[model samples]
Target: MSEQTDTAAVPTPEAEPTSTPAPAPEATEAADVATEVAEVAGAPEAPEAPEAVTEAEAVTEAVTGAVTEPNVWAAPPAPPKDRRGLFAALRWTAAVAVFAAVGTGVAYGITQPERTDIPGLSTKDDGRWTFPVLSRPALPAGAPVPQGPDNKDGTHYAPLTGLLLPAPEGAKADDAVKADKDGVVSADAFLEEYTPEAREKLKQSLEWDGLRQIAGRGWTTADGTRTHVYLLRFHSSGFVDAFKGCDTNARFTGVSALDLDDVWSKAKNTQMNSTTLDFPGAANFDGTDLSVYQEVKPFLGEEQTKIGCLRTGDVLGMVIQTRKGEVAPVTFHQSVILQSQLLS
Candidate 1:
């Protein structure tokens, strides 16, 4: 008998039975490789059930010749673990710390004074006079300074009294200079520096020459040294040169005759620094002409006299120092240098 075959209707209970279960899926080669790499790299253990599902899917795909997707998607590679934000925060913190330190330093510097002004922080002390701080007076609105390119005649437009050097500290004033409250003296007062016989002639000459004004300052130190400084301002530099009061032929009251101060020339040449002769301003006597003279032997009185003549621009400066035994050269040089600096 020929039977018609219908595969869909036939009962294949012996081929596959529902009461019997299929074996669990085995670990695939890909799962074994992933586990070994994870252990070596210190990664957390993966779920074992997902591995079994992947193996089963792979087997089905091979047997049925159709692609089967894996159960686990591997979480899309975890997005590469972004760390740019953490580095940016660290950099900002470092920048803030640097700025704060700089701000603190600036504040401290603004509040503190100079180290030289402090008592213990001052520099080494030399044998220098304690004089007040020196500052040039303000000029007239349209006037130029002496020796400036605009002022060809080298005229000093500032007040003659303002150009005078102030007395040093701990000095007593002298009444012999005959200076007024404004430090101004008369032609007769300035002529007192010469001998009695010369005063009348000098007075007549001062009135004829273009003598504008005279400013005088005198002080006595604790060591009995008398210092007298006089500033003679003329109408122009030419008149300053014509004044004979400070020339080599000039005659002082107490000094019989004048001789060139060899000590001054030697000190200037050697930049003298000795126990007896110390010249701090020896190298700084520019912008002026200096002539120093000492009293000849057999002085008129028991005291010795020295003269310092400084010609700067339209002014003639005379510094006279007198002492009982001898006038200190150091003090005389200091006075001349300081006066020249003011004129310059």
Candidate 2:
């Protein structure tokens, strides 16, 4: 019993640190019995075994104490190494690259040529009047297009009135032409464009020529340029060729003589637009033959007149433009082209 008491007291110093945790009741009872046994037997308290607690155990106890109450006293870990400098440098490099690309693009754009210097982009509008969108009139159900393989005689089967070109945007209608609801005017009304003596001759020619109908439209533009477009439809293409109403020998009311338009001759030489005409006018049309004329210089009554004659299929298209000062070639050519499209 005395030996047991001394042995129990030998481990007491090591158990002192473990007292922070809950002590077993059996261990306490055993301790009490060993103390009573020691007092009754009059045994001496054993000296503590210093070697029982080596350096390893002491370190373990300290580490355990620190880990148990970590939040209470442990200093925060050192912050992760700062990387904002490296990240900032990468961002600056990317921004510089992007700006360099954009700047290069702008510099290239600035050094390029002007739009007008380019071949296809070199077009600009020259004083041409704006006409409505021109469309061909619809043909009758069973009729073929004029001059087609099936229509060898080149007969236009559509209504003559629908084939007449409408007036331009700002032009006021001329009431002098006297076209009926069917767009037909009498031979007398058509002859009014010629001198009284020439009218008599043209009227005789029209009466003998198989003239089927005459459809006319007239308008005066804002610039005081008067336009009269007339479609004289014949029985067939043969009759159209035989008619002499719009030919070079035809006489106009006030013009002394008519000659082939020099502007038109220059336009034909350039293939389409003539720089001499000073405007971009499409002066030619396929499937339609043209005989364009202008009144000779040394104006009669200080007025100029220009005429365009189109022979399309079985129809003879006549365009007359008169202005006090001078007739603009561009407007005259535009009117002829628009009229030719409707007949073609």
Candidate 3:
């Protein structure tokens, strides 16, 4: 057998080399699925999930170093404010307020009155008056007689002067008769012109109690007779009627003969003889007439005095004439008639 094997080896071909073959497709597929499963289930435990980072850790890391994680979550930044738009809104509001204030001021100015220019009279800053203006009253219409010449140039008395009795033909406006428009003589001052007893009686009379205004004038006749006239305005006609009672008896007239007697009885620095007479043309009028003699130095002759009083409506007039001789009753009657006509 040995001789036979040698002989066969000498003639046999070299045996072929053996090699490993590729795995089957099913086995490779199974092995790949097992590896994927193992990676999913274990996967090195995913490094313990990095211990879930919080907002504080994120902020701390950001402050300490530059952030590296691209997927890190955070809140978005706030949008920029519009400063120009805010300023524009504030400017419009201010403009509207200023316009409203100006409009209100203009409306108020339009309602005020215009300023006036006058001496001694001034307008206030608000266009009101500081003092009232004074003017003369107009004359009443349809007078019974012509009035006296008006003294328009006279201070404060021009209006009243037109109602006074005219001076003698050659007489002039007397400065002594001039007074303030609102008379200077008060009730007490006027009473001083009468005797004590007459003053006392007048103070108790109705006319004196209601007296309102008094104006007086002095005149000299062409023949040198001195005359003084007094005008008294009472508060009402009833006061005038009470003063010169509504009676035909001259003595009953409250301001008639009895008043004349009292006045002469209390005269000082004079010895007087008096006569009370019924005034002619005055029977229907409220009037009285009186004649008196005043004694001067023994060598000098007695001074004659005549007086008359009359009332028309609420006005009472008195006329007194004095000279060296007895005065006529007609003289006082004429004077009273003229005054009454002016009053009417």
Candidate 4:
């Protein structure tokens, strides 16, 4: 009995895995290992790369997806159970940071002042004015600035009278302008350089007429030739006078005040024969009391500027004018200027 039991345990050719038409031993070994691997209890799942989304888009998409989908839908898609979903949040945060940085740079550049090559801030220079600009003229350039004399030569020559005072900016000029278009100067420069008293005195000056008798309607230097002076005086009712003498309705943007002064201001050098007989106040071509200014006024053009000053009592209706610089007296409205002197 013992021998028979031993044979049963030891024999049966040790049937190796009951190999059905068994392959080589090595192949059998490989099959066994493969079967073991397949039977592993659990293997980790591969991590997936997160899809990037911007904050704004993610919010919009989330809202849209929520709103468009029925609340009744399958439990709201299980709330992305992946803990790594925090990666989506990080991606959204990075996208927002990039946009904010770009927007900040543009705003800073726009609010700054442009760089200037000028010494003090920015000063513009455009020189092509035969007359004054919208701005006033700069300081007068000549011998002794702000000279107390009206004459270029600087003397009592013709008592400074009826000369236009530099008008305060915005002060109307016979309804046409504040002043004859003057040069370009700053408001500070104007006030500092020009004084009211100087202007008042300038208003007192007389143009062209000197300390001599302007005789025979035309004055003659020792040379026999006489000057047939055509003087015209204009009255200021309003815009009409600024037209010089053309059309009463004509308009003139300002002509040049100083340049005109240049044209009319004469040297106080010439001397004449007579300083007697109250220089005829206002005269007509006929020289007969001549109350009518219309007869001899053909020479006065519309849009031309008239010169005069604030009047004193004795010089009613009298004004001075110069059509050309440093030339002879063009016109002096004696009556009006003299009348102005009667300012009540």
Candidate 5:
């Protein structure tokens, strides 16, 4: 039996275990490629949740309500008034008022007539010559009728005393009896008393065509000052203008006699200086021609001498005043003022 068993064991080869037939090389490589593909193509991820807000941010949003944009369609706010602009408007108003006032005054001045009476030398319009404080001299009782039939030419051959201005306070008529009679004289006769040069000059000056007559008076003051007044009448207003032209052109200063040798020298001394004379009134008095002159003569001790001539309508008037050692109580302007009043 032992022998038979040994023989059997030797004869039965040990059965090889069947290891999953050593996998094929190609199949193993295919499985490895499938695993790599799966790793490259990862699975799709899930969506993330939103972040939470803080408590402070939530409280601020609740307190200030939601902000909104301004409305572009609404009207804008009105602009503030400018204080400087208001002041400028007020200034413009005041300037307009001033201009209006000035315009009114200018219009008034242009429309109004020129005044006749001056302030200081006011005259009365009571058909006679009168002043504010001084009364006019009364006509001598039953004085000879003016320009009587005997003087048919109306040449003023009769006495002109009634027409002459009254004497100053301290002065009296030079010739009380013959003053009125001697006042009237012919131009030719009057020129005869002057030097030849003076006579010739006066002759040419007095050649005012249509001259009717001339009357004049002379007075000597206590201080050796001399005053002369003359009145001239012309036939027509044209003649008066011509006479004034000649009188204004003639120089009557500095020359001892009416000589034209040094006309330029004499002209320099005849300029009209400032005085109280109402020249504007005199010039406008019913269309008058007026002029004033200065005369200086050392021989007569006269430093201040003045003469004024005026022509109004058909009448001309002249006044001459001379001052010697002292200032004359009456001024040439006063004489002219009174004389002009009488003439007016």
Candidate 6:
């Protein structure tokens, strides 16, 4: 029994601990390994990103103004629409000139055909001042030219050369004037040469049948140069005169001494401007200064005739249009000498 007690006291050889609980350290180590493996398996990979949006934004900012705005352009305002005045007319005229310079006809196509002919004809080809040149009479050296015009005896020659000579008092040239066979010659025969047909035609055209009948008488003349002179009667007086209207376009206007202005006050109020005739009287359309009155004002006495006329308007006037300057001079002695005895 004692032996059995001692054996019982001594540890008995038992089977292994089949149902023993595991230690806490081993359980904690297993949990740590499982946590590590779970973390490794469930971690997310690096993500694939969006590509061109940033570069596109930079390019958009570079091209257009704003990155967040629309790209359409705002248009500019147009010119105001209003009625035109002088400046506008000038502008339009300049534009038309430009178009014409470019070989266009849109501007001047609106006016009348008569206006196409410039008044003074600055252009040489324009036919405003034109006429048929009368042919000179052909004579075989000295063929004994006759004394009278057509041998009619109605006309009388008022001798002007006689006025220069010493004459008897009260024995005037006008008193000696007669229709048949007057001994003195006519002054007009020296200025112009004329054909019988042209003389007759001009007489008829100017309606001077009385002067024609009178001039038809044979009168002795000095110079032989032929010209065509037309008789002109003054409206203010019954005084008759003649001029060479050879250039049909050149015209002459005569104002009477009754229409003279004493002072320049009221006269300056009227602008004597003609497109063909210049104010203050320039000779040519281009600009050649003409005026016997202006140049010789000091020579003409204050009481002398100061008749001023302009070529611009309805009043007809005279222009010689001959190649020669001073075709008709005021006087051979003094340029501005007002012939009180003649023009008056």
What do the candidate models score in CA lDDT, each in turn? Answer: 0.76, 0.77, 0.47, 0.28, 0.51, 0.28
Q: Report model 1's TM-score to 2 decimal places.
A: 0.63
List model 4 lDDT by residue over 1-344, tens digit each: 44454444544565557433433343334444444434342344322212233335445766677434222212222223343565788788999999888878766654465434433565352211121122212333552321233433221122222222222223222221112233222222222212343433322222221211111011222212121121212222121122221222212122222222221122112221122111233211111111112112233333234433221211112122323222223223322222322221
| Cα RMSD, each candidate | 13.0, 20.4, 31.7, 25.1, 32.1, 29.7
Deviating ranges (above 4 Å) for candidate 6: 1-197, 205-209, 212-336, 340-343
Q: Which 10 residues in a row give candidate 2 its minimum summed lDDT?
A: 69-78
TM-score of model 6 (CA atoms): 0.18
Give the per-residue lDDT digits (tens) of candidate 1, residues 1-344.
99978768765567644463332334333345455556645797544434234445656676786754443323223222234665687799999999999999987865596556666777554445667777678889999988788887778899889988888899899888999999999888888889888888777777777898999999988878888999998888888888888866887878778888777877756765543344345566556788888887898888998898988888898999898988877677777778877887
Give the alpha carbon lDDT tens digit for every residue of 118-201 in model 5: 445454432221223433345455533223444233332223444566565556455411233556767865453344555665
User: Across residues 1-344, which tens digit of lDDT does each residue of candidate 6 receive?
Assistant: 34444444566697886654443343344444444444444754322222223444546675776655321121222323343464588799999988777664534543444443646433432212222231223434433221234413211132222111121222222321222343332324412333333454554544442222222111111221111111222221111223233232222222112222322223224442323222122222221111222112232222222222211111112211111122122221111111111111
TM-score of each: 0.63, 0.63, 0.37, 0.17, 0.41, 0.18
Model 3: how far is 195 from its true place, Å?
1.1
For each candidate, how many residue pairs have backbone atoms clashing (under 3 Å)? 0, 0, 0, 52, 0, 12
What overall lDDT, based on C-alpha atoms, would model 1 receive against the true structure?
0.76
User: Model 2, range 206-324, lDDT digits (tens) per residue?
Assistant: 88888888999999999899999899988777888887778678878898789999888877888766754443335546589988999988888788999999998889999999999
Point out the higher-scoring one by lDDT: 4 or 5: 5
TM-score of 3: 0.37
TM-score: model 4 vs. ground truth: 0.17
Backbone clashes in candidate 3 total 0
Ten-residue stretch with the least lDDT total in model 5:
45-54
In candidate 3, stretches whose alpha carbon ends up further than 4 angstroms from where it belongs are 1-162, 172-184, 204-208, 244-301, 328-331
